[model samples]
Target chain A: MDTTVVNTGAEEKTWGGGNKPLNASYGKMMMWFFIVSDALTFSGFLAAYGFSRFKFIDYWPIADEVFTHVPFVHGNYPMIYVAFMTFILIMSSVTMVLAVDAGHHMNKAKVTLYMFLTIIGGLIFVGSQAWEWATFIKGDFGAVETRGGNILQFVDAEGKRVALSDFVVAGEHERVEHESKNGLWFVDEGTLPTYTMQEVITGFESHPDLAIRTQTINEQGHKTVLSREESIKQLKANGIGIVEGANLRHNEYGTPLFADFFFFITGFHGFHVFSGVVINIIIFFNVILGTYERRGSYEMVEKVGLYWHFVDLVWVFVFTFFYLV
Target chain B: MAHAHKLEILRGLIKFKSNTQKIWGVLILLSIITAVEVVLGIYKPESLMAHVLGMKALNWIFIILTIVKAYYITWDFMHMRDEKASLRRMVVWTAIFLIAYLLFILLQEGDYIESVYSSGFVKKDF
Candidate 1:
């Protein structure tokens, strides 16, 4: 096989196939194509989210209220932890670009250091996302699901949120959870909520200061709180079950769709971050072993850096649409 | 191959001494923009709550700032700016146009369904 390009007369034409029209290597161009397709995939998911949100535009769950937990501090601090996560991802992106820059200069030491930092940053971000998911699943103030599937939360006279434990008194009724082993072979039930509907209703009747806050948002952008009389009427007549946390079937937050989108989008993005970290580890070892040094080019590092930065880019959009917007 | 980077951002208004310096500079700019977004989200001023172009002015600000951040991340971190002009357009323009079209169709359909739910036989509350 002839290994050299023959000097064909067609080589001088603009339509010649021998030239690099895009001025990019094959690997880099393929990476760009992959990124573009992946971006469209993410855009599809985000647009679906926006559609759901717009459908429930009047009563969509407020992001600040839903994501108000910090790891150690107890008070309501919304958006702080998510902001921290965003900063970590952005800073890691900076380090990744620095790694690629060092690779350009052929400084093996700097590339190794920056790659290590980028991996650490990726780990921290993924861990934080896991923690966030856990916190979201374990809700704070429990709400009652009405027969109409509307969520009814408890609030004090001043409209401050009140936890079920603060007011609900457990009754003496014997309750048992159903299991596949104990119940019929094919039958089972989910975990029982901490407070039953009877307990919540009784508790509401006993506390005159408590009010019912519906999922509907008023013109003031706040949940509509009913008067004490209306609160009692709504609870006794409509309250069917207590929703303690979030799941695919039900959410103590406004709508179940909100929880579904939250899990799917963030879960997918977290999976990407996890894979990015794994790839960075592989590349980090290759850098240490001087694989690129022997190859006489650090283009592999540049390729992986493109992927790492793309992950960061997607997170920027995720952070905006989910948390900030 | 030694590659030369265009060492400026914001249409040459902000220049850096080197590629590494540019990376840090873009990082700072992104951080500041994120900070501003968080602050505005937390406070949610009354004046900004007024409707503008069928959405809240505050929300418009957020969306615009988000696009700005996306631009810097793509151009600087992903080295899209250094790519050939044809490749840049093929990647960036493709995503942008498709996303815009998708959002328009989906949101319009969503709004239409919402109106049906509000006024049509499908009752919102049982």
Candidate 2:
């Protein structure tokens, strides 16, 4: 006996395979899912940073004041360099889009060129960020950290920030940092600061033009500037040690938490950028190798383009929250 | 897959001949927005500093502009516009809802902490 199968097309439609539910390729869909999760992770970090800023609302360091350095010229041009960095990243996103368009058009030469431009843009951004981190670590105007963990910065009569090296008188005393190789078997202290507390105190006392500025913001939205007498008194009463730059434990800018968050968020973004550069480099060579051309589609270029664009998108938010805000 | 050549960026008010042109248009828009943001941040006009709904008007502007930039980057650069509606909803909606919920909870907690500190529960000065 021969069995007859039902010709119901409806059942076949219900169990159909190879149909993209989102109308996206498998790789593109997976990339979107990854982006969503990665976005959430970044949001969590940024929201936590917001929480800390709110906690010390009035005492938060001013972004313009903290990030005022340019590569070579640095005469208090606020937010200029960061603005340039943002522009560069956004331009890189443009190049990535162009590369995707070129891929769609099956123009191998254009794709290679655009991808090369994108890689260059990423390199410049990462290098600039590294320079920024270095400048932040080597603070311009040194401050004295209070015993209570607050920072007291120095200013001149006109309320301009004054460098510690400007007035700090070096003493004949030699400072030593403990190393593992040094006599102590288990005690290894970090590198010592350039200037000592005694030197700062002595220098501050002699410089009548210098005053102290607290981390607290005044009604005018600037750091509070104290009178000369109050400056000396406050420093003498609360100053415990000299803090020249930012670290995980100490921040000459303000609360150490700000520095901690800054390092973690920006460092994480930098790592993302680094990986994006590496991925772009790999894909660049692939485009030159005509791998995708032989495959008859340039979907791989589009996929990596999505990733590159996501990195730019994240940087936009990071720039807003960290620098502009 | 057949990709559309023309992109109606502003509901057909502005149209692009090709995808490359559309990308350039979006880039210009993004750059202009960034420039405006930078200028506002640097100057911080006093009138814009007036508190509106507990936040400065300037800050509100910055946040809104940033969202606009993010939207365009995701939609255009990432080609969310060309994707199927279902795919777009799945990716965009999930992120929107999750991020909103997370921000609400975190920001509320942060406001509470701010109130606690400002109300003198714990002296910050040591």
Best by DockQ: 1
True contacts kept of 2: 0.82
The numbered model that scores best in lDDT is: 1
Candidates in order have lDDT scores of 0.91, 0.90
TM-score versus the correct structure, for each prediction: 0.95, 0.94
Q: Model 1 — TM-score against the truth?
A: 0.95
lDDT by residue for model 1 over B28-122, one digit each (tens)? 99999999999999999999999999988999999999999999999999998999999999999999999999999999999988888878668
Residue pairs in candidate 1 whose N, alpha carbon or C atoms collide under 3 angstroms: none
Question: Model 2 in CAPRI terms: which quality?
Answer: medium
How much is B78 displaced in model 2, in angstroms? 0.6
Candidate 1 Cα misplacement greater than 4 A, ranges:
A1-18, A176-184
lDDT digits (tens) for residues A44-104 of candidate 1: 9899999999898887899999999888888989899999999999999999999999998
Error of 2 at B20 (Å): 1.2
Runs with alpha carbons beyond 4 Å of true place in candidate 2 = A1-14, A176-184
